[model samples]
Target chain A: MHRTNSLLTELKKNKMLFLMLIPAVLYFIIFSYLPMGGIIVAFKYFEFDKGIFGSPWVGFKNFAFFFQSGQAWLLTKNTILYNLAFIAAGMAVQVGVAILFSELKGRHIKKMMQSSLLLPYFISWVVVGSFVFGIFNYEFGSLNTLLKGWGMSPVDVYGNPSIWFFIIVGFYLWKLVGYGSIVYLAAIMGINPELYESADLDGANIFQKIRHITLPLLKTTIIIMILLQVGGILRGNFDMFYQLVGNNSLLFNQTDVIDTFVFRALNQQGLDLGMPAAVGLYQSAVGFIIIVSLNALIKKINPDYALF
Target chain B: MAKNKIRRIDMLIFTIIGYIVLGCISILCLIPFLLTVSGSFTDDSSLFEYGYRLIPQEFSLEAYKLIFQAPEVIAKAYGVTIVLVFTGTLLGLFFISMTSYVLHRKDFKYRNKFSFFFFFTTLFSGGLVPWYLVMIGLGMKNNYLALLLPHLFSVFHIIIMRTFFTSIPESIGESAKLDGAGDFTIFARLYLPMSIPALSTIGLFIALTYWNDWYPAMLFITNPDMMPLQYHLYKVFNSMQAAQIVAQKTGIPVAQMPAETFKMAMTVIVTGPVILVYPFIQKYFVKGMTVGAVKG
Candidate 1:
């Protein structure tokens, strides 16, 4: 009764503040929280006329169908493996570039490199997709032209599936590595220069200082970055995959991921009922589990790095 | 003496490798853009016959002609994109800052509770179907509201905005309150102006998101007249349906258009303005990203 009295007083005191929160609160309620209940559609036979809740309930049939589709394992494997590659390679390149950025002495040269590197990050995926098309298109691709000019056989970048593993990863790095490096660069800039000076006093070389000091100091940032990435292992970059390898079912074996697969299954197939919703729920469930587990693990190791 | 010499040698090697490797990567990044621009200028026949050359073997304005041939459609898309960016950015920055201000209010005892309430959405979301249904149920289908509302406020933006608000001394708000400003007045008159750096950064980020957005347009919008630039480009590049749609609307022949240079020209048209506008807002974006990275 006493606690309730105090809570009422507090609520009355901050009435304006609470009023300010209504927009955000209502947004979350309508867009986020309400839709959360819609996850139940994943277990239902959704009809346009019947609606989400009005649809008849079905259980795990969508999941079973996805698994039986024979592409389930491939999608799962591709999503996880591709993310792993991105995490590892993205970190190394980002950290390496960050350190390189810090080492460069000429301000003009540094600015130019940084600007050029960041150019790709600002452009839309639609633009990047077109650029990639230019490089990989069969009749007028840059690579094929070069190959032909050099008296070698031209490669079919489109029809081939195997080459896309590199293409997807390369394009991702090309597009995002600059954005990623800013994090490491910020962390690098924040590091005290005195630490490097002391290392130099100890007669440590550039490589040793980087190995012993820079990388060690960056350990937490790197782990946090990787741990952050771990949550999205199940979700694919639909924009990148869609724009780059798009509709080339021939490359599906190499490039098809959960997002693209579900997108096609939903939009293209009109795959009966709520199968796309079911897959989305599956991705979310898996993502939630991984994030929670990772947070708990990180908190145990170092409380500072816990996302929560 | 030997150790000193070895250290000198190492630094020299590192510098050499750094310059070489970084130079190579820079070249690799720049060349494709150059190729595309040159390819855009090449005549239709030469593009397919000779392939994409850094310099056009037979230069032509055929591609430019095709795009300029349909000015009305392109103008409408541009108008839609600009309006989307303007409204979305302003509303997003206002509502987000307003919401974040409350969360960061020094006297607000329920701040943590509300923070989690907002933060929870980022960590967990109901999957796509219900979200789509909620949108459709709300009658967002084919509506401009669908594009504006879904991305208007993000949990991540709220977090960043909240952090920026916290950095402002409580005394600022307190003094404003003493000066007879209401909570809303203090936020609008005092806090918003004082928070220019944060405002610009967040505003630019939101604007860029709107500018680059096609996902919402893809999902919700089907009207060709209402199509934004990015989605329009995606359509043109991805399918013949887009050309057929254009032909249907404009009654122009797409058959005679040069496929190679025409598509490349479209890429330039859609992307060139943003690239030009980017430098002005580059610093703000970098500031926002740094804040998000370090704090988020």
Candidate 2:
């Protein structure tokens, strides 16, 4: 009775704080948790009239069709591979640029370069697609013009399936590297200046100080970021891939990731809604499991770095 | 002696590794933009004659002229994007700050429960398909509300704002409470003024989202009048005939057309505002991230 009274008293004391949180609570309920009720559409036939719960149940049929499409394997491979490549390449570029930007002392030069570099990130992928089309179109492409001037042959970058992987990767790096580097630079700046000053006073030069200090310090931030990204590895970046390669079917072999495949199979064909939902369910489940497990591992290694 | 020797060795190796990596990454960041920008200025006739380059042998303002002629379409897009950015940023900042203020209050009855409610969305979502269905069900299709409503309230920004708010001293609320200030009054007068840096970061993020959003426009906005600037540029570059029509309208010489350059020029033009203001934005991004990382 006494414990219950104390608990009630505590709740009463903090009532205002909780009251303030009501709108945010309502927001999530409406937008997020409620939509989870629609996940049932994955298991059902998804009739328009019947609605999510009302739709007829078809046990694992959606899963079966999703796997049978043959696009399942292709798209899964494309999505995972591209993401792995992006994560690996993006990490390398960002860390490298960040360390360099940190080492340079010229504030003006650093600011100019950082701003110039970050400009591409501000533009939408739709605009990026236009830029790609402008430079790569067959007859009027700048590549062809330059090639002719140099008495060299102009290759059709758009038609060539092999060339797309490089172009898309380049585009991804161009749009993201500066922003990612900025994040890392901020992390580096947060490192105590005293650590560097002490090392310099002890007659340590720049390379020795960085090798001893910088990389070790950035490890936790890097690990957390990596784990966060790896959770969504199964999900493709629809905007970048779709905008750049959407209309061009020939390039789909190399470029078609899971998101695009689902979009086409579901939206374009008006085919089985169940399969795409099942695919989405699979992606989410796998992603959730991976993230949880990864967090567990991180917790085991260093509880401080674990997201949860 | 051992520590000093080790430190020197570490510095040498680190500098070597750091410099080479940064140089290569900087080039990677720089070269493509240069190619695109310089390539844009190169004559289209010359472009077909030669490949893209770091510098243009012959320059023409054809692309600029063509784009400038059909200024109405582009102008409308710009207006839509700007209005969305302004409205979304203001609304988002208000709601986020208020919500965070409530969550941060120690006397809130169900603060943890509410936090969980918002935080869970980030952890688990119904994926894109269901969200699309919900939008369609809500009659948001072809509606401007579709663009604004779906993304107006961000859980991430709320979390950041709450984190910043939690760092504020409790005495503030106590003093305000003593003065008989209502929850809204305290939030508006005391908390909002103190959280400028955090607000700026969140506000800028909201602004950028509205500005850079072609996704919402693509899915919901089929009307040409509703198309945003980035999407307008998307249509222009995809079809050369669109460019030619603009050229015809503008009365620019056909042979002097810089179609490729115009697309590049458009990219430069649209992103110019962001480039100019980025330094100011960066300061807030750095501060907000630090606060978020530490509190979170």
Candidate 3:
């Protein structure tokens, strides 16, 4: 009774301030939490008029179908492998570019490199898709044109699934190297000048200093980033996969991911909703485990960097 | 002295290699779009015969002419995009800033509690289906509200807004309170005007998001009339039906459909404005990066 009385008094005192939060509070409740309630549709057969709650429960039947489908293993494999590759390759490129910039130390060149490199990041994935098509399209494509000039037969990039692994990874690096490198640059900037000065006094060359000083110090940021990425290994970059591959069944073998698989399965035979919800539930459950464990690990390493 | 000489020699070698690598990569980054632009200007027959060329053998405005032939569709998409971006950014800015202001209020006892509530959403989501179903339940299928509502208030944006607000001195709020001003007044009159840089950066961010956004638009909008610019171009590039629609409208398929350059032209038309405005707003992206870079 006393707690209730104080709470009411506090609410009354801060009525206006609280009122300002009403829109945001309402927005989140309606959009996020209300939808979260609908996740139960994964276990239920949802009907349009029956809605999420009134739908009949089907136990793990949805999950059975998902696991039974050959696509489940493939998508899971693709999602995890692609994410790992992207992280490893992306981190390497970012670190390399950052170190290069840190070493080069030319104001004008740095600015030019940065602005040009960042251009791809700013452009839409749709435009990037067009760039891919422009280069790789069999009829009048730039790659084919170059192959002709080099007196070699043009490779059918579209028909081949294996080539896209490189194409996708290549574009990923090209787009993200500049943006991702900023963190390393900031980290590099934060490094103690005295350590570098001392190394310089000891006659350490650029490579020697970087290997000894920069790489050693960057290990933490790199690990933290890797750890953070490990938590998201189950998730895929839906935008990259969706735009690049786009219903091309030929490329599905190489490029199909959990998110895209879920999307396609939902719409495959005209809005079969439960199976997709099952997939989402599976993703979220696995993701939750990964995240919790990673957070625990990070806390053990350094609580300061723990996400929680 | 020997070490100094070695260091100088290393720098000299690095300088040459660095420029070559960086310059070549820079050109590679820029060249694809340049090729696309060049391809868009080339005539259809010549494009088929010779593939893409740096300079078109037979220069043509046929693609642009065909695009402008269905002027209404193109214009409608641009209008939808502009209106969506404009309204969404303002509404999002107002609510996010308001919520942020409340969160940053030192006197607000439950600010951390509220902050966690917002932050928790970032940790997990119900994923695409349930969210999609909810929008459907709300009758947002084929509705413009679907476009605005989903993109409106991200937790990331709110947190960034809070960080910006907290950076402002508390004395300002205290002084405003002493002047017999309300919390709303202090936020609207005092902090809002003071937060132009934050507002602009966030506003540009929101605008860019709405501009580049095709995902929600793809899901919610099935009606051709409701398509935004990005989705509009995406549809054109993805399927032949779109080209048929344009050709059907213009009666211009007699010239081999011009599908190749038609897609390229659509890309230009949709993304041209963003390209033009990019350099100006690009710095603003980097400015806010370090502070709020950890996006969920």
Candidate 4:
């Protein structure tokens, strides 16, 4: 009774704060929590007329269909492999750019370079898709045009499955390297100038200072960023894949990820909600396990870094 | 003296290599945009003949003319996008800041609980199907609210805002409370004014998200009139029929149309504003990203 009375008094005292939180709380409940309840659709054979709860359960048949189709392994492999490639390549390029940016001598030139580098990050994927088409379209693409002009046979980039791995990773890095570098740049900026000065006093060169001091300090930030990325390793970037390789069946073997698979399954003529939802649940369950385990690990090592 | 000379040479070599690498990357970043611009201006026949180039072999304004002639579709898209961007950014910023303010309150008893409430959503989600069903169930199909609502309150933005709020000294809010200012009043009259940088940073992020958004529109909007700019451009890119339809409506010969150049032209037109305004607002993005990373 006393605990309930104190809780009521606390609520009364901070009523305005609670009031301010209502919209956000309601947003999450409607958008996030409610959908969580709808995850059961994975096990159901859904009909539009029947609605989510009214749909008849199918008992893992959706997962059976997915695995039977062989897309389950393909998409899972593609998603994880692509993400691992992106994470590794992105770190190297971004950290390199940040370090080089620090070494840059001229302010105006640095600003201009930074602006140009960041230009791609601002535009929509649709625009990037057009750029890809302009450059890689078999007949009219700039690359083919140049090849034909040079007395060489034109390359059919889109028809080829093997090259798209490079194309997707290239565009991903192109769009993000500038944006990603900023975090590292900020970390570099945050480092004590005194450390660098002392290194200089010891007759250390720029490379030596970077190797001994800058890199060691940057290790934590890099690890945290990588850990954060690893937590979402199952979640493919739907926009990037969809925009770049839209329904290109030839490239599907190399390019298809969990996101695009789910998207196609959901949007295809006859909605098989069960299979797609099953795939989605698979992604979510694995993703959730990864994140929870990672958080637990981080909390054990340093609570400050734990996402929870 | 010999060691000093070697050190100077090493520094020079490093600087030279840095310039070359950074310069090459910058050029790689810029050349595609240059090709798009050049292709937009290139005559139809020449574009087909020569492909996209750094400079147009034969300059023509036909693509731009065709678009502007029956400008209603493009203009409507722009209008839809502008409204979504402005309204979404304002409302999202207000709600995000308000929530952040409450969460940042040292005196608030449930701040940690509330913080966890927002943060927990990031860890796991019900995935796309359920979320799509919820959106459909809410009658968001073909509705502008679909675009506005889903994006209005990102947990990432909330975290960034809360971190910004925490940076302000607690004594200010405490003294304001002592002066008989209520929480809302203090948030509105004091904290809001003080957090312009945070507000603008988050506002710009929200605005950019809305402006570049096509996924929501692609999912929810089947109505042609309701399509936002990016989705409209997407449609133009995917279907030659869209360009042909526009050309036919304008009484231009479909055979004479620059469908290839038209796509590039549309890309330029859609992306022009962002490129133009990027230089001015990019620093805030950098600041927001850096701050978010530091404590996120």
Top TM-score model: 4
Q: Please, what are the lDDT tens digits per residue for candidate 1 over residues B1-296?
A: 98789888998898888878777777777777788888888899877778888898899888787777677778888999999999999999999999989988868988999899988887788877678779988998789998899789988888888888888899988987888878888888888998888888888888888999898888889888888999999988877977776566556677766876878888888888887887777777777888888564
In terms of lDDT, which candidate is stronger, 3 or 4? 4
DockQ of each: 0.74, 0.41, 0.68, 0.79
Work out the TM-score per prediction. Answer: 0.96, 0.87, 0.96, 0.97
TM-score, cand. 3 = 0.96
Task: Specify the highest-DockQ model's number.
Answer: 4
Q: CA lDDT of each candidate? A: 0.85, 0.75, 0.86, 0.90
Cα lDDT of model 4 by residue, A1-308, tens digit: 99899779989999988899999999999999898888899999998889997889999999899999999999999999999999999999999999999977889999999998988999989899999999999877889988988999989999999999999999999999899999999889989999998876777887897899989999988988898899999999999999999988889999999999999888985687988999999999999999999888878866888887
Flag regions of model 4 displaced more than 4 Å: A1-4
Model 3 score (lDDT): 0.86
Instruction: Give the range of the ten consecutive residues with the poorest summed lDDT in model 1 chain A.
Output: A265-274
Task: List the lowest-lDDT window of 10 residues for candidate 1 chain B.
Answer: B245-254
* Backbone N/Cα/C clashes per model: 0, 28, 0, 0
lDDT (Cα, tens digit) per residue for candidate 1, span A1-308? 99899889988987888888999999999999999988888888788887766888889998888789877798999999889988888899889988998876778877777877888888888888999999888877989998999999889889889989988899898888778899999998888999999998899999889999889999888888898898888989998998898888998988998888877866753446478888888888888899889989889878876778
TM-score of 2: 0.87
lDDT for each residue of candidate 2 in A150-194, tens digit (9 for 90 to 100): 788777888899989888888898898777777788789889999
